[model samples]
Target: MQMPKRQTDDTVAQAAWLYYVGNLSQQEVSTQLGVSRFKVLRMLADAREQGLVRITVEHRTARALALADRLVTTFGLTEAQVAPVGESNTDDTLARNAVAILASGYLARIAASETPVTVGLGWGRTLSAMADNVTGVRNSALTFVSLMGSVTYASHTAPGDVCVRLAAQTGGRAILLPAPFVTDSAAACDGIMAQRLVREAMGVARSADHAFMSVGECREGSILFQSDIFSADQIQQLRDADVVGDCCGVFYRADGTVADIELNRSTPCVQPADMTRMDTVLLAGGLGKRAATLAVLRAGFVKKLLVDEGLAVALLAEAEKQGK
Candidate 1:
């Protein structure tokens, strides 16, 4: 049966918006638009076939898709998404923003679920960009929980801030960990983790249905060093210990083993072991993060990955070299 011309056009447009912009599933769109699932599918196909929806990216789309597929196969990832590199191919911010956009889309789709969900978030510039790009989504059943403690100083990229922004954007709730990212000593960290509020928040984090996190390079110019969360001596010490990068607040070596350092012991964040129990998505980009990204993947914390073209190419090359 055919819908009336005007009604069909309106329905097609609405279905496109709900699926593309709203990030709703086909079933959800069918329910909200008061149509059959098969009809919703047909409308979405019509929308694309008629040029009502257009998807544009700056990089070579075909190459990016192939790279994503290779990454999934080589790394044993459940899924992988690669964003195209900009003209310069050297702009770290642009690469990060591209990857962030992919991450934002992933989160939006997850937020559209009918059942309640708890999402654990980690702190970083990329994650902040993801939070900024998320819009037009309203799901009260979604809850964002900070997987790590807050930065000592004010910063929009802090875990607490990212959680709050995500919660605000989705009309959900934010559960923040009320402790410092790193304490002065292991004893201090232990004491903070014992607090009622901190324990409750951590419990929620550990039980999260899914978790999104970014890796940090264990180097001089990394965010941890720039934020003064770690001093020059500390960075040098980590390097001395062969530390390559960190996920959440736990630093690790090139082989994916957690570094046995005092800094790691004093950091209050959900451990990597806990991440293995949930669906963990690792978002990273920029050419400089190749080593760090590889390290995290080796650590086996990532089930899915979102990255830019340059990084994706580098990772594939690394996998080839290692004969993976």
Candidate 2:
């Protein structure tokens, strides 16, 4: 009789640590431990079954998970990650950070893939936080491309900045769009887009396998307004045109249709139509963005989403109200 294969406690403990403590997914743990994903899953199950690793789900986390499932089902998204708001549901910064952490984990997993991947990046505080939170990921096969033009002023949340940071973290290359976020006029924008360097960069951005973006609300306190990219009159004009939010420089109305406005024509970036060709992950949070988030989702370009509990609940309620 042959001896049966034995499951070791030491291996189980290492897998648990890598997954639960190190924040690595099963696939990542498998890559690190030189084991199959099935083996890692079995080890994790064994760890839990043996009571060696205690996993507790808080009420807020449980609620967030349920909301995430509803979002995925309602919106037909490939995946939805909702971070628990805890005691600071009203705190936008906290919510953004929580969602960013989840996005960072997702990006890390993508970077760990053996196959080369070109990722397009969009600008926002949450995306900036995601780039900042990425650690210990070094894949030379990765390429980070800016999906939009650079902000006129320096900002960590700018598309170029986020792309560079992600590239640095992953030991990858960064391709920056050599144009402004918004040009002076439509003709100027056309001229810039026609430039060889800008055209090449945009080609890379458009051909990226994966993309990450964030929705910007069309409000006075929005980042676009704060960046001085749009004047008070322009902001009011967007509001007057029923513009609810923007993604990749394409502003949209509450009904998810692109707004026919001067800003939309002048802003040079990846269009919603281009986004439909690739896997796009949208990261957004805060109650202020609830309407904007819904509008972007309705636009039918996002494949995955990462949001906080407050935003998730608001989106679900809004979707039901709209009879979606």
Candidate 3:
């Protein structure tokens, strides 16, 4: 009788290894090893079942992870997490990923709570993109707050648009903050604040069970700068102050400390102290946004920050290389 044929040890090992390492797809393994795709899949399943393949996800951005730790230690954060910026993609994708991750974590926290309620939404394209990425039961009684009022013109979606989106995703009440982003007179802002509806919304914010926001920068196209709101002098003042970035209309100076600016002349929004109190999360990335990113960090607004590899590496290297 012919001797029984032993199983191909190398084939089994290769499939198992590739499944764990992410270097090869089932198709790739099948093509290389002359096995059917179905067989490869089966072998991978067997690998997992038989304990030959195990998976542990290390954070993709090791450098960012380390930097986040250092930042958390230096800044005393509640917690910090970082994601990798894909080598082949733009910074916006990386920023969105970080935002999604942070949002997901916060939503998880809120979901586990008893009272399903009140969430404050920070407006901006970056934030709206994040809201777009959010889905499924957020809260039974979710409330969205307009972190700030409206921008000047341009017809872009309002910041409260993020609130609306959040409400839809998590199934809760979204409180829209409706007042102009900036005003010609201080009285105008005071009058808006005096409105009973706006007051109630602000009160909801004060009792915010969860607050979601992105840092703002004063660049021409920034959420604040480009919203058709800021005037020439206001824009010029921001430039003069070397204000890099902000969160919830909060600006910061070049040394990574909060910079004094003139944005609050129009709207009374969340401050650094309130931010320090809440479960604030920040999302920022991109090679070009180094100044803004650094400004935000120094401003000390982010309790939890989400960042990507390109910007993280650039920020770390720039801070290290040039000592800015």
After the best TM-score superposition of candidate 1, give how far the Cα of residue 222 lies from its true spot, in angstroms: 2.6
**Residue range with the least summed lDDT across 10 consecutive positions in model 3:** 1-10
After aligning candidate 3 to the native by TM-score, how far in Å is the CA of 265 from where it should be? Answer: 1.9
- lDDT tens per residue, model 2, 90-142: 99998898888888888888888999999999998999988877767899999
Candidate 3 per-residue lDDT over residues 1-324, each given as its tens digit: 233323554567778877667588778888887889999988888766654654323445566567668657655567766665553346575566565655555565676567656666666665665665554455675567776675656332466767776677677666766677676545667788889988887777766755677666667666567555667876776788887776665567777666555555556565566655567776665555667777666666567766665666566666666653
Candidate RMSDs in order: 9.8, 10.7, 10.4
Q: What C-alpha lDDT does candidate 3 achieve relative to the native structure?
A: 0.65
In model 1, the Cα lDDT at residue 33 comes to 87
Stretches of model 2 off by over 4 angstroms after superposition: 1-60, 231-233
In the range 196-303, model 1's lDDT, one tens digit per residue, is 999999999999999999988877677666767775666776988999888899888877788888888888899988987788999997988888898889888789
Candidate 2: deviation at residue 146, Å? 0.6
Candidate 3 vs. true structure, TM-score: 0.71
- Candidate 1 residue spans exceeding 4 A from truth: 1-60, 86-88, 231-233
Backbone clash pairs for candidate 3 read 138-170, 142-172, 142-173, 143-173, 144-174, 144-175, 216-246, 256-298
Alpha-carbon RMSD, candidate 2: 10.7
List clash counts for every candidate, in order: 0, 0, 8
